[model samples]
Target: MAKFFKYKTTADLEAENARLNLDLRFSDDLSPLSQPVTVGTRTVGNRWCIHPMEGCDGNLDGTPGELTFRRYQRFGGGGAKLIWGEACAVNDEGRANPRQIALNPRTRDEFAKLVEQTRQAHRDSLGDDSDLLFGLQLTHSGRYSVKPIIATHDPLLDPRTVVNKATGQKVTADYPIITDDELKRLVDDYVATAKLAVEVGFDFLDVKQCHRYLLNELLGARNRPGPYGGSFENRTRLAREIFTALKAVVPSNVLLATRMNGFDSIPYHKGDNDDGQPDPWTAPLANGWGMSESDPFTPDLAEPIRWVQEMRTLGVDLVNVALGNPYAQPHFGRPFEYPPPDGYESPEHPLTGVDRHFKCAEAVQRANPGLAIVGTGYSYLQEFFPQAGAANVRDGRITFVGVGRASLAQPDWVKQLQDNGKMDRKRVCRTFSYCTALMREKNHPLGQYPTGCPPFDKEAYGEIWKEVLELKVKK
Candidate 1:
């Protein structure tokens, strides 16, 4: 194992960690996130790819605008190598935020602008040798597919998660199940979006399979009887066929990967057991939908490894591993109440949380070193990421580490270590469970632009930051 060098966050190590470098400036080398890094057969530049977030910049109708123009330019210059265009809806209803960038037409100009600005800025920041790859997370919320419950299925086994509009009455679903043709259209949607991403300047694509989306639903044991349901092969058929075809269609230079969630904490799902069903694995659909799984998620490593193997055989470049998703249960480290309770994140919960994801990635690395494996999880504990990454790199355990939430608030997280030995540990975000909670809300609308953290959102975005900062008896 590489000698452990830890920090509070990348910001915690700041300039101090730079001295430990074995290879600086792989391209611009000075920049950590922008620097080229290796993954399986293909090389992934830098260590960071901005996690899809709400409204850093995008128009009201999901178009790129000055907000995104300036925002991406700011972060692009910050030296991030792989910049994913925001979580774009493959179809209209799939969008996470009404303002989220869209991959389809009518938003083409904005996307092109996004492509131009991000590329020009990155190129300018790192020079030609710096290879910053850009990608977008193609996602659909499924039951949680995003407001109005406009899912493919009827309200059979829906969670009935509501929207938080001023005129709030829970956003109940009348229709739920997706049709066979619709499923195929969903596949075509992914292909079209992939093409659009490539055209808009994104060099990579992550067909999102995480957070109980339409894709994972097919893969899950709970999927109702359909051509896509039943055996594991049937479940993964769409992902396999779609991504494989996309890999062929997109340019050879593009890096393609998928971010998926396998278990939901609720009953009939793999992660949770709230319903107390004796045969958790065989819970019948409340209406016609199937129940969640009882056993923990195993992610069928053999399946994805072979999948990655096939992709590499074709032209795909990466395989990111994951375990239970955030939207799913046990929810390991998230809050039961407000302020997130204490002792939750203190390494107590193992298989039930994001820790499981780490363990999953570590295993995937050892087994498939040739496949570029990227693993993602929470905001905290990133300071230990490099040391964790070293194990994967040196031992061929893993090739890359992804930080989702921490980087969201403090965009300059990595370089702070490379530049000044100073890491901003006093998180700009105060562990409020906004991220986890808001989505779980009853009518959480698709275009609902949540400003600031949750639970305490009313507090922080409401003025908690000002009050706390002022009251802190400064040393």
Candidate 2:
């Protein structure tokens, strides 16, 4: 296996970037990150955004459990002005896993308390909570859902959604796809969830359209028939309709947003050597959101650019640009030094993945200069993430630098930078993928383990990690 992270100094990291001819830049001046930015009618305190990192620790009734409260409380006190919350299903059947949080009248009170606690923690640490902007991400995990409600048949991804992994019983071609009438009902689900998010005191509501979920899958459903597929206008019909319906119901102060996939690269599998390799497919691939028809590996931003421009017209105030399907090509979205137990080794250098994120986000930002764009793929950079983020903000490449896995490792990273002008190297995430491993572990009575930085936040997750290790040994 390749051990890529060996940089002992900032200069060493820069040298490696230069060697790769990557456009990734860094700056010692971190003042740019501290500068406030305007989103909708609110002015976010800073550019450091704590991405919605799910713990999968919710109670069986869909309430925030003790660990869930602890996780968000840390993010509230972490000092990032924008806290993009994790995925909460709009309905029970939409949940990706048994433990995934679902929002409804039954669970609304708990959500309100979660929001209140998060804001209170921020006020205690930073002296004020008015400048902080928090959002809730709502999603329906399409093919990845527990029972697999797919948009269309995908030759590449179908095999991975196994009914029984040991028996290799996969989803068959005869399996039914979600109908247009069902999609219309799902739109209502999103609208209802948006209203609850506003009532719960969230600053914004993210209609999650990334990571090959239901809406994202519809975006690439060229083969499917009817008004919700085929043409570009038809493909985006559900999202447009949902956004329009949300605008009519939600108050003007509550912002409409989406975390969208800028590109859906082809799926990969473990080769003979246990390294990730792309599955075989012919040119002119039918199922990909922002990918070139002729070359599925490379990004074709034409549709994604047009979609963002359309979102601006439909009153979308924020857009978080993400890449790849985490389940299929994990390296594309999250460049990791080591792969998860269920995953394979990196197919290419992690630096290459980082560069792709920068270039794609740059294209989207330049196209839609009006929308507040949050760029992903920064967690793999570790210690120098702030420097790169500052440079990007200074260059007008992106408005916010989003940190996902790294936030679990150091929730107070924003405060650390404000005081010391650098991160605590000892606490910086090394991209070990332990969090991903925990997310995959479903041996518990509650159906899944809560994911966190076991290496850094040992007090909370060390014992949990031991439990996972023991479970693996027995398996």
Candidate 3:
């Protein structure tokens, strides 16, 4: 078990970090974090960034409800210069959850109002909006779509679909794969969504490719037989076309971006070992993107580097790096002490997971210095996040240190850092995984649940948790 994050003092934290051969450092001034950076034609106020975190509480028609509005409003007031707004589906059928927000004709006005509310809240709290940038993450949950209309069937992702719970026997489902014609239509939907985002006053639009969404899955579609699969160019054709179409419609000031999965690890099982390591498999690695073809555990940055160079040419602002899919390989992307209800114990130390993300960010930043790179997997550091984050920014290993779950647990952590250069240890994220557990529980196609910091905002999610536990006990 990891003991370093439990330390109360900087001295003890530093001692543990040194023992682990980690070069974490802290500063009282926080000058590096407060420094302004420029992307595209705009200048951001500071280096702190809030990664996109979904609330899963939108209206049935995919409009922002009160909970969704409140979540973004708090994030705005938290003082992150660059806020990557949560993922919103481009169409109804592509939604991952029934309540997932969608940018469409009916919900356009509501989304525009939500953007204004978020910006005004930031201005009211922080006193200025001159350097703030908000980007909307647009996605199509192809394989994970709750609707049966536009689902994808990848051999690597959807093989042996049915599993008997009691006997653990595998069986296949007869789901049809998404056709190439549908992909072309998806391109149009993306372009139209981009136009709506720009009209709604967003500074940028993120074509989300992380966490095994449609585009990310397409990146690794080696077995599919179509114009959009097999070779590298064929696989990446959709993203390039989407960019071209978006650039043609949107104004030059509207920046294009992507939150991408930079690496993936082999799947693990609980019974693999007593220590929670992955089981040995003679089966070759699946057609997952960003991993070495021969060695799935190691990163193969050749394609990612090439994609970065291509993105620069296509006017992409930046790429936020997340590793693996939360459904299949949760630990690689989210380093948590506790696992969600459906998750297995972590196969490696949480610090090792954090280190892998840092290394991936370093490799991408080193290869493509011009294209900004935001690093994730830092929230596990708790109060020590600032020390390691500041060190990475100062050394130019990454452009921005992103806060995902931490933002929920402590929305005002940035303000605290700005005010005193130290955080109240009590408020720091403990990696409890309650937020993730709630998400997994309320992920049904008809479930309308709100996601937030249960421990901090006990009035809402805490009560929900109690009800959940009661139901569990009754079961």
Candidate 4:
């Protein structure tokens, strides 16, 4: 309802933010975005980072095809120093979708070629690859998996996320909890995947722990017993073990990183009654992660600070900070004016959502200034993104400004900013979330590949959406 992009100047935006009781900042000069920063041993050329966004365009067998190659090539040539590549399942059973990319002996060599070509493209455009950092995010989809192998039977997400909108029934008839022994096997899988990444020539490997994936789910496992759940140490056991094992095998130069969820809001439903805010419970909220148990919505960064300190001690090069799961609470993660197919409306102004992200990420950065932190939620700012991003980076609030959907919408955003010193409002993302809408529709029978900006790439995704709308829901 705020319609932030309507404001033309930083002062106008600041006035609006103040009126809303929001803590936000913006700088007219965007030169801070072009400044170089170091992560562990690597010196990145700029503060812009391309956050990993998977294109469901891989081969059925999980190999990178022409579309996948083209996407990375564009990102490399797009002028972001740090390219945080999209999630690639360590194994098949853990895949979120059938088309999700996976790393293995069969696909390792091809992934290597993909990485090489992307770097070559970067070199060709930027004239230097010395400070470029490329990372591959390896993950297990967990509760949202096509397999439905979950870490814990999360009461909040179980019923809501399992049902397919089309059929109004559970996709996986049997919802099974993954055992500690299976988790140990997953550790081996991660180590194996890390080894493959090193051979494939990645600068770092992201042991992904955000967005309610298997590992992130495990972090909030307060009920499940054994070495992999219950206590805080137990909940974090998998990530700690994976890092320790991986470091021993991979060469010293290959860095380790993670994309972490700073906080999680409650799952939102689509209805007139749904305000898109957390529902009040009886005092202590159950199964909450990164939030006060007493007040499920307000952030409690104590544990998250400890988690960052632990990562720093474990020698993590950087941590890309994100918030909420796109599947359950899309608005908090990616504030959009128009929701996805089965999504709820925004409960608060998009600026409030942006403020929450900045505050949470800044908390982590303040606690561990040495740990390079990549900030999300800037894409919702539209043309004013660079101004806010520059202000935050200059103030030491975040190390890098990570752009996800905006990068997909306009690949040459950073390059244009560098050349013209201003973002083209026409090409800027309006937060319509057409990309995510396409991603959600893949659950339906007539859905096409889940990638590209439908608003921008009308020929491909928009046309497919037309056919998708004509098909009947499975139920």
Candidate 5:
């Protein structure tokens, strides 16, 4: 309903920033981005990182499909020093979709080849792969899983959880949550997966704690009475257990990392004019990891800061900070110009959301100066993202500039910056949200449609988008 991105130059963007009184800064000197930084025992080649951008195109058997291979290969050659691999389920039932990749004995070989080819492609493109750091993100989809394995019940989110995708039935109050014993058993699955990841040549393993996945949901499980819920110590028990378990088995050189939610804002629903509006709720919210219990709309970062401190003690080398539950408030994590078909239009200016990401990440980074913190919510800045990223790195606000939707649009963004000193204007991501729309389309024979930037990577996703349109019309 509102047009936001209308800047024609850096000056215009700066004017808007001034008008909004935002802390966003930019630098013409991108040298900071090219500087190498030490992450754990390894030195990453640059500050650019490719966030785990899943295509949802893996085989039903949990092996990398053709499109999956192609996506990683492109990222390998695209020149980012750190390649954060997409989510791979710890087990079959934990999968977000039928096609989500899962690492196991049967698919171990395929994963190994994936890592090998990705490194080979990087070597072929940059003449070296020594500085490239590759890692895998392990997760259980929890509430968003195919069968909805929720951690706790929330008045706001339970009704939104899909119990049956076919009939669009949502979860009820009586729906069972994952038991504590099941959570302890799930830890074993993570340990086994971490062993497999090391064998497959991944440099790090991210026990994913973001996006309201199983582990992340556990972080906000304040109601469930067990070892894995209620108090802060109990809330973080699973992640700490997983990381401690991983450290004992894997070699010291293998880094243990987590992409965690800095703030889990309350869910927003479609309001007047189809714009996003916060769902009605009372004070002292029951389930929000890094949010204020008394005022759900505001962020209270005390717990998140403490969690990062504890992670350092457990040997976590990297911390990628994220915000919001994508299923409930997509705009909070990714500030997009448009919304997905199932999503509501952003309630506030996109710049406001971007500023939220920068401020939240800065707080965490400053709190844990020893850890390498990767900042999110940059893709919405379009061509100016590099300038903002450079300023953040120079100012010591963040260690890495990670992009997700933007990476899908232009995987070669790092190379572009290196060779041309700027991103190709035509290839820049505008935050159109087409990728999110494709991600929400689950009518495909394969259980879900593969998501990519149809506007930019037309060669791969153009036909896929066409099929989505056709399917939508039939519905």
Candidate 6:
């Protein structure tokens, strides 16, 4: 019998402290959550993956430093079947944050060390039996770059860490529109980086295709041109190109995944044109993509067997579904958007219908084999995934389900479910959205977000705590 503790109420706790003072009960009648599943030949060290959360990779001169290695290793060692090393930039201009880890050959040694630290942390803590896998969710912030020097369709993206593209110096990025050569280089960089991950000892690489990224911006009918603009095929071509390039350089042994908005299924901005671009200079700030309160634009986009089927054809191992609208923070899926006082608990929360999304993937699988779908939208509600997936698989529906935010709060979340019979039993992850505000650095991005626990970081984000205190998870 697992013990239970409830001294603290489920309130505004930080991500690190979200899962504290909890207990579990297993039942013979209630089927166990299931066991470690396979991602190809590789068995997840545990089902709960510490989903790709972002942070500076602590690079000094385009190379990772010891401090960065220690930080990630600590998180990796804390335990996870897989850990995404933030959103690594594929090329220089594609970089969003100046310190984000880049997979370029220029930083190979640092990455190699990072790989070593990941394995070392897992081996030291859990022993040889644990095969802690690592994947890189490579991204090109495109128009939504954190660097003020970089230009995009909408210029309001918080310019906290502006980067000087030429020298890679920490300068203000300007509205520098990219050219054809730059786009090709971006594709090439993705291919080269995919190869680099294998060489550096990482397991998989997720070619990021969602949010308001370079590709997304092009595909979204914003400021794009030629064949890459018109139909969905045109829009999706870049993703296919990048993935195809990755497959060529990266071996069949490596797992390739992508985090994309399965559909732009949300309502469009009323004032803006049908495309949801919003007025670049005059419209309200929230009129654009994520700026809208309407459900995520991509959620409404789930359609045509073509998009899903193509993912399978593109050598994609997995697609982590996400909302490309307001759901993605200023930097694309950072922090988190909240509604009123009690947000996560909004009656609309959790998407009243998760099965529909699974159905879309199912339709795709019929045409394309071997492509696995893993996702639960980085929610702290970890158990909801497997419990739902277990039933889905029984009905020939879902093969895998991903749990992101919860895993960050508790890395061994999967183990807890395996050891105990039920997932709801564990009492951690108040889901207070502390991690959200910290991640967003919401007070206009000048490094205002809280990183660990606010109380834990007096020097970092105590003021940010004031905003966090306003919200509650509404468990």
RMSD of each: 8.4, 1.1, 2.8, 2.4, 0.8, 9.2
Candidate 3: regions farther than 4 A off: 1-4, 21-29, 148-156, 159-174, 272-286, 443-448
The candidate with the higher TM-score, 5 or 6, is 5
lDDT of 5 by residue, 229-339 (tens): 999999999899898889899898889999999999889989979999999999778898898778776778999999999999999999999999888999999998888
Compared with the true structure, what per-residue lDDT tens digits does model 3 show for residues 1-475?
3333567666776776677776555554467888889888888898888999888889888999888888888888888899999899988888888889999888999999989988998898899987999999999887667743323344444542333334644334565677888888888999888888999999998988877778888887666677988788987888899988888897878788899888755555565443355545444554667876568778887887788788888889878988988877788899888776777777776777888889888889999876678999889888788877888888889899899999888887888887866776677888888888778675235584667778877866788777766766876
Model 6 stretches with alpha carbons more than 4 Å out: 1-46, 60-71, 129-132, 148-177, 265-305, 326-347, 350-369, 378-386, 393-396, 420-427, 442-475
List the lowest-lDDT window of 10 residues for candidate 3: 156-165
lDDT by residue for model 4 (1-475), tens: 2344567778888998999998889998788888888788889999999998988778878888677898899899989999999999999998888778899999988999999999999999999998999999999998777757778766667766654545766534266678878999888899888889899989999999889998888877777789988888998889999988887897877889999888875777665664565543554545657987676677788877898799777878889988888988888888776677677678778888999999999999999877789999998888888899999998999999999888877887888887887766677888887787667666443233567787765655677566555653532
* lDDT (CA) per prediction: 0.52, 0.91, 0.80, 0.83, 0.92, 0.52
Model 4 earns a TM-score of: 0.94
lDDT of 1 by residue, 232-351 (tens): 666666777777778778886777777654223332232132221212333344211112333233333554455455556655566555544343342332312222211122222221
Given candidate 4, what's the lDDT at residue 12? 82
Candidate 6: how many backbone clashes?
Answer: 25
Q: How do the predictions measure up, each by TM-score?
A: 0.72, 0.98, 0.93, 0.94, 0.99, 0.69
Scored against the true structure, residue 98 in model 6 reaches a CA lDDT of: 57
Instruction: Report clashes for each candidate as comma-separated counts.
Output: 47, 0, 0, 0, 0, 25
- Model 5 residue 461 lDDT score: 95
Tens-place lDDT per residue, model 6, 396-474, is: 4444545555544555555455566444434344444555555544332332332443433334446646655554332
Ranking by TM-score: 5, 2, 4, 3, 1, 6
Better of 1 and 5 by lDDT: 5
